[model samples]
Target: MKSNQTYAITLVEYAYGPAFSNAMVYSGYYEMTGTTAVEYVIGVIEGPSGILLVDCGYDPQHEVAGRESRAQNHIKYQHPTKVLKKAGFNPEDVSGILLTHLHWDHADCLECFPNAKIYVQKDELFGWIETLSMPKEYNTLKVSVDICDIKECINALGEDRLVLLDGSVEDLFPGIDITVAPNGHSWAGSLITVNTKDGKYTFTGDTAYVKDNILGGRHDGVSMPNGYNCGSVKNVLITMQDILRLAQGDMNKVLISHDIGVWDCFESITTPEDDLRIAYVAK
Candidate 1:
């Protein structure tokens, strides 16, 4: 079946920072010569149904902590709402948020889009709660989990704004399908595939850090697992393999959330001040 519906998929870079470390971008397979950085982006699918954000960017406070903890050397944080406005969108115009998982960087902005319903994996919500309930030591080691973000998700749930998924895959909207990552980079991580006029575009939210994780590590001919797998290394590898199959060997169709190189892969627009950049893949 051919989809008459089309979407202009845009990647908005709301924040960026020096890579967690040289190893983060290069993976351990390659030598850490120096530090590199990665951009944190939120994917936008604009279609007849309105704007559907794949992941909402984080709050600015987290960027401060991120730098203090050495999680990143520098951070340039911008409110997703403002960033969206610069992209010609209003926060109230958003229809839904397809959250990959509840990591702080991806879900902290939940309150920013007040009118949008959140689409997330049921397992991811419960799994994160389970993690939060774990011993302080264990939870503290998982830097990706932010208590404030968890609270925000709980608030959304309480407000009955979450459309939780129990299954592995679901047709979210016209020409859009979201598949839960097999094991997931985190608990129940998700990959969103959009059928645009250009072709199927897959947004692998942290499931595959960069092309190297799917194509094979940069220097070595082996696939490397993501650094922060609140799940398991084995699960990450399995998920990576699944992502490859879903892409059907079309590299351009797979978009990794944190990869800075994404800016180069699609048609992009930069704001007049050059503070924000949006890359699009569409007809």
Candidate 2:
């Protein structure tokens, strides 16, 4: 794949926003709680020709901290500033954004990348408003960062920046593809497939909290919202079926947006000098 093109991938740390107490740990999600750790990250895909972000990490201020903060949108916005500087770039230097669902953590700071084009699942964007009422779409009150609500996106981005693509996707870039999985955590949930040196990596934004959920076959349309469960049992069934196909083991490797372990698949370098020798990132 390196021979196919010259590019770099950056996994910048953002907010570390979750609070895990006893009950959470007792329930087997000890990692989701306590002072152990929290992480919010966004993936930067850079080819010799372009710069694209996997998702927009959240805004960490208290005002946006309510439910949006539940997943612990782990962040250190300074991570962006620092990573960019070390890479000889800046926030404004980003040229494109591929929003993975509109949850605040993944969509809040889009304004920072004013010069980019934002790509998303077309159905996911429209579904945000219409699907909340559908049992299959699940309650999106918390996940809905619909294009219209952000106001900033509307005011600064205009509709062009928000291109919604639904269903199976073609080559999004030289080696990447966008496949919107309609399993119910949110209306237009998308799973991003990136063709990397190691293999194909699929980034699932909240489709599941941990890779096990996907391994457990959760995307079959029966997906339960993280920290909330508005999904229909019916949705879970279909999503599970979808995972079965992917799990076949060559098509892709699933990376959950909230999974701390899966992050290891990517290598993290403190400076640009570390360069693009690996496929994934980690803390």
Candidate 3:
């Protein structure tokens, strides 16, 4: 098993269109991939590292309010086993889990890989507490985000692998880095980068609802299409500062968790080294 083997990722799922409706005015958010599939990337890092998973999508068994809730749209999952099986992997075979942020969609499913180390932004675990009691004007969910999953992450990996690093620094890994681009999008949002062939791949987890938000370098504001607290221009700007650091252009590729246009950009082929990265399609 070569750790330096070509790293790969897959768009396990992609959702498009307006979501989190209540967030529209405040967030200035238009495109919402709310009820969408959870994207997972199966990477075969350097020698025998087995595999690393970033942002495990929602579990099929977990059910919430239907798409009508605006918060919960047409959420769908391709079954974790199916996604991993595509790469000849099983949950137990995974080595690590790096959750960009624990919004219900991203971190709730950690139990899937009970055997892997869970890495996250140290500040993000309780990042939402500050605004948990704020008024609706903040677009706050006030749903009392469950920390049980995070605790599970700590226990599974012995609290050692439950890593919390600077979201503004790099070198988290040989070809990896994360920046805490806080837009109050969902808790302490983060921007992830995976260095690839020539440049790096940017994973903007819900920090922005769509690709244009980061690509164009503009905060579309906070959107709560889900009846939660819609975001504000000021907070979104703070998030912008973090995302811009990652850069999403000639030098990088932007992966929006819910953008259908962004998702379609990648091929559907399955494998540990899935086709999810900066591409040079002819203009």
- Compute each candidate's TM-score over C-alphas: 0.90, 0.71, 0.68
List, residue by residue over 1-283, the lDDT tens digit for candidate 3: 2122234554443222233342342243443332323233323232234567767655434432122223444433345556566545677877777777776556666777767788776666655555544677754364424444555666755746676655566646655666775545555556767665545667776665554454442343332222232244566556655565566433226665655564356544423343333222111
What ordering of candidates by TM-score runs from best to worst?
1, 2, 3
Per-residue lDDT of model 2, residues 1-283, tens digit only: 3334334555655444454332321223333444323356677777754778888765545345445565544333443445555555577777788876776667777777787887777666665545544564443454445333355445544646766576767576766767666746655566666665555566666665654444432334323333332345355335534544544543236655555554456554433443221224421
**Ranking 2 against 3 by TM-score, winner:** 2
Ranking by lDDT: 1, 2, 3
Tell me which of candidates 1 and 2 scores higher on lDDT: 1
lDDT for 112 (candidate 2): 72
* Model 2: worst 10 consecutive residues (lDDT sum): 274-283
Backbone clashes per model, in order? 0, 28, 30
- Candidate 1 Cα outliers beyond 4 Å, as residue runs: 1-4, 26-29, 62-71, 219-221
Q: Which stretches of candidate 2 lie over 4 Å from their true place?
A: 1-7, 18-38, 66-89, 130-140, 143-149, 156-159, 217-225, 229-252, 269-283
lDDT of 1 by residue, 1-283 (tens): 6455778888888777765565655446554556556778888888887889998977756653354434464455668888888887899989899998888778878888888889888888888888878886785545777777777777878888888887565456878887887445788888888888787888888876677777765535477765666677777777777677778878888998878778888888877674668887774
Using lDDT as the measure, which candidate wins?
A: 1
